[model samples]
Target: MPLNIVLLDDEQHVIDLLSAYCESIDAADIVGRFSNPIQALNFINNHPVDLLISDINMPQVSGIELAQSLTRDVKVIFITAHSDYAVAAFELDVIDYIVKPVLLPRFLKAISKAQNAISASEPSTKELGNRELSNREQSARYIFVKDGGVKKRLVFDEILFLHAQGDYTEIRLKDKKLLLLGTLSSFQQLLPEGEFVRIHRSYIVNKSNVDSVDKDHLNIDGQDITIGKTYRQNIDEIF
Candidate 1:
């Protein structure tokens, strides 16, 4: 299911940019975009939202205050130019605190963090105590992939990297590899942003599996992957 998202920013351009970014991610659905904090608050109260992307400094009501007024279950990601609010943003337990001007890659990373947080909060079948289910049960940690005639479930944490094939994507795990009929861009939208990064045009590496990184390349579990020039700036910010 795509996550319902709400974007709030006083600046029209910021709102437009964020809305466009959200639209690019297949997992996110921007249900509301508002320049006024009060209108955003009202919309959120009336609609169901899985994530909230908001600017820190606004007119009448601040983003921090707006977040405080929300229910505990709502996840928030703060985007702002000032660094002084970092401590306060974290105090509210926001999913991420991004300093502007926000780059596409960095924004993607923050969105991924929010997705993971929301996934973690969802109740699993096991948690609900349903014992009649089959042994092959699906959970937030795994995704179902069809390989040839068989359907396989791949765990998110077990994945090491994903490389783009002609029109398909090859997912590399610690023990095996799976090929799916999809593009790198599609995978980019589906996968959590915080855990995976597009080091190259054809490759997305799991940040947790990354062992080390240098100027031009990054090592992931003994395998070396070249970092693309265009992504260097974002990669630098990450490491």
Candidate 2:
């Protein structure tokens, strides 16, 4: 499942850049983006967030103080134009401290660290067929995908299956299909491992939507998908 992220920056342009970067990564979802530190804190208190990227030099409630006041263990990454606050920011044990303007490579490196920390701390997340690695994971029920130049929300339960088309993925819902600009392997990283299974070279089906299963074929939404030879054993174990 993707990480829920919050962005807090006093500047609107900075927030826009961060939002675009987060959307491009596909490994995270922007749960909230605020220009006011106080408002961002309120939302973070009431929501489940995995990471927070904040500008340290805000008018009210500096990012250092905000990180200290968090009610839960949410990882923080401080971004500031001035390097003078680095010492104080690190005292709060933040994930990373980034200096503005935040470049793409630096942001990606920090995100990778946050992902590692979250995966280690996650109490119940599935790792493909290894149920023993974790119990049932508490994951977001939906994901955001851009389609037709507009971002669309796709619920996990509403999705029937996924079809790989070279570098893009076709998400098959009950009524319509939404295409995403990503490979099937990359898209799988964002999916709840327990809920979806790779049954073929080009298809991944929602386990709860399965109607029938045989040695070579599995049925989902009344459509039969041939099970890949390598994945047949997984089907047996999962079913």
Candidate 3:
């Protein structure tokens, strides 16, 4: 039987591109395309899918959550614009993650990955995988944080680190910064376990950005930061 699949993305252009490709592919049956995550989730619950092609960043809920709910029976290939989500995406055991704006060849490669995952035997650590998948699902790869009345969606990969000050979280981006309403713990939970570590109670740094680490000090992109006593052991393993 041809693999039954669903494609979910907030961008109509992306959905149009992927839908066309899936229709052209011989092995897949393009079941539907949904811009809304809730609608996609409902459809998946009512249907049996062999594979799902989804966007990691979406409004309200993410593709990660949808993938977690159907991981046992369906393979997921996430499409995202950021690289930081890559670590968490892998942890979820997604067949692949295709960064946007997605090229046709790359999108096809994701489909290939899903096919392989479907053919592969069930993994031994289903429960552990499920739990890990849930954490990654709920974690935000792209945050729609509000600065006053203005709302902005920031990709997590663009953020250098978050600085906590009382009730607000300082979002330091690659180019600029934004002071948003959130806690340090909330940002930490959104980051992948091995890829991001809490260097201090108020700071979460991406391991991929760390230039060097010795004892209590960590150098990330020429910036010096200290490792908290509580997070020392965990940081050590990553370095």
Candidate 4:
């Protein structure tokens, strides 16, 4: 039987691209494509799907949260522009994590892994080979951010904090800073929740890099940043 698959991403273009890719695969069937994670989750709950291709960052619900909420045994493949969510994806035992600006060849490789996983889970009529099909890798400890058309790899340990700068975000490192064209909320969803903390509406600090903390502000690398009043509760818990 062909694998029943569903696609979910906030971008309609992404949904279209992934849908076309699923159609190209001989053993896959495109069951649905949704821009809303909640709608996709509801569909998955009411239907039988073998795989879910999802984007990590969404408005109402994140793909990671959606995968965590599922009670069924559906394999997931995360497609996103950010690699910060790699740790969380691996924790969820997703079939693959494909970075965005997704090339067709790379996407095909991910689909192949999903196919192997689905096949392995079924009762085989003949003896299967001993070839290992697992795709889990060492959790990613860094991410590549595109700056001025160049991809700059930044290790997680080197990052001090992320500050929202209008339409872009400033990534503060140990020595310098880089601007990325995305929102703070997007990065918040990308980074591992345990390592990064949202101290304010405009700032997300690397908890390990924090030097000190007070009621109104926290010091990271000796630079004090204001803590939002609404986020004071989280700061209280951390301190």
Candidate 5:
């Protein structure tokens, strides 16, 4: 089925452009289009919205705020002229965030991503309690995080651990480190349950990547990370 999509932007022209792009590929059916985010939100509450394409820096309501207001299973793709809100979009688990003058190829790619995400989330005959299918699902897990101007796509298994650096979170892999502009709690939300545990206020380690665990710290990728008193329970439960 084609996705039920809503396009929202303060600029009528932007909404028209997005509508045209979606129309070109027949990627989605434009169920709604509104210059006011409030109207869009209200419409979404009463309708089936499979995908939401919105401009982030609107005057009525920021796209980030609009995405946060919804409490349903709708996929979101954010459009903005600025890259300032990418980290916030990341925390919200948005499918894709495009900066400014949305191109046809990029927009179609985002729609495709949303379609795949929706399809993957739905139960199928092959995924019904199939252990091998579960392992296949694990292989497809990944997220896009910005490292400076470049967006790095890291598979879940490649991540060794995560560390809090005040306002930024450090993503540690076996070979490199990337500091994303968000808190550890934000990154923690992106990880799968039971696979990653918060060992300290500043540290979260992947259980699969840990070399050893003692009373005070855990060794991961040859680096020692101290476990906090409060989070010892997390370690115990996971271990």
Candidate 6:
């Protein structure tokens, strides 16, 4: 299922950058982008979004306030420039708290948590919406892939990352890349949470495969991928 998303922030640059990054993630679609909180609230009244990505500091209303007012099962990921508000963000039971200059990789970390959380149970306002990895159990250990008209079965752990093209996802393994037709999200949902994270909108890197991360990028087996500003916190928490 595609996650319908709404993004609200006062900054146009932040909104545009994040909107593009969200589109790249291929996990969901940004149905609306509102610079005005009141307008955003009004839009919400008429439309139900599966996810919300909002800025904590706003003139008329705070992200926390909007979160409290939300009546739907939608999970929220708060984007803030200040680190001081991280505790407060979490206190509101936000799925994830991200510091400003959001990176796409970090954003996916939040999305993963939210997806896992919503998948576990029916979402409600009062329940903590954050995705937790402690309760996860291993399911499939291997995946069967078709390459050159031949079926190939490989262990899930053998995958290093999956890179997305226009209409296909290149599954990167330890030794080779397999071309498969589908959205990156389809493979993302199939992968185990603890082992993998979408480091870029187009790339899902294995946490174990990651060698290191710099200020603007992540290093995985000598490959560097830019991280979006909004996703930094969750990335820091995990990696």
How many clashing pairs per prediction, in order? 1, 1, 0, 0, 1, 12
Root-mean-square deviation (CA) per prediction: 14.1, 8.3, 17.9, 16.1, 15.4, 14.3
| Candidate lDDT (C-alpha), each | 0.80, 0.81, 0.73, 0.80, 0.79, 0.75
> Who wins the lDDT comparison?
2
Worst 10 residues of 4 by lDDT: 129-138
Q: Give stretches of model 5 more than 4 Å off.
A: 123-239
Per-residue alpha-carbon lDDT of candidate 4 for residues 1-239, written as tens digits (9 for 90 to 100): 67778888999899888878877988877666788898789757545567899999999999999999886678999999999999999999999999999899999999889888887786432112101111111156765656876888877788899998854789999999999865565455456548889988789999999999988999998899999999999989977
Q: Candidate 3 deviates by what RMSD?
A: 17.9
In candidate 6, clashing pairs total 12
Kindly report which residue pairs in candidate 1 clash with one another: 112-193
Candidate 5 residue-wise lDDT, 50-80, digit = tens: 7899989887788899999985677899999
* Per-residue lDDT of model 3, residues 1-239, tens digit only: 46778788999998888878887888877655689898778656544456778988899888777777663466788889987888888888888888777888887787777777666756535435545644654476664555777778877677677788754688777788888654565455445556667889778877666778999998866778888999999887777
C-alpha lDDT of candidate 6 relative to the true structure: 0.75
Candidate 1: segments with Cα more than 4 A from true spot? 124-239
Please give the distance, in angstroms, between residue 119's alpha carbon in candidate 6 and its true position after superposition.
Answer: 1.6
lDDT of 1 at 189: 52
Deviation of model 3 at 108, angstroms = 1.9
Task: Give per-model TM-scores.
Answer: 0.52, 0.54, 0.49, 0.51, 0.51, 0.51
TM-score of 6: 0.51
Per-residue C-alpha lDDT of model 1 across residues 1-239, encoded as one tens digit per residue? 77778888989899889978877999987666778899788656544567889999999999999999874357899999999999999999999999999999999999889888878776643323322221123236565655766778788788899998854789999998889755565556546547789989899998889899999999988889999999999899999
On the 0 to 100 scale, the lDDT of residue 40 in model 4 is 86
List where candidate 2 sits over 4 angstroms from the true fold.
Answer: 122-239
Please identify which of the two predictions, 3 or 4, would achieve the higher lDDT against the true structure: 4
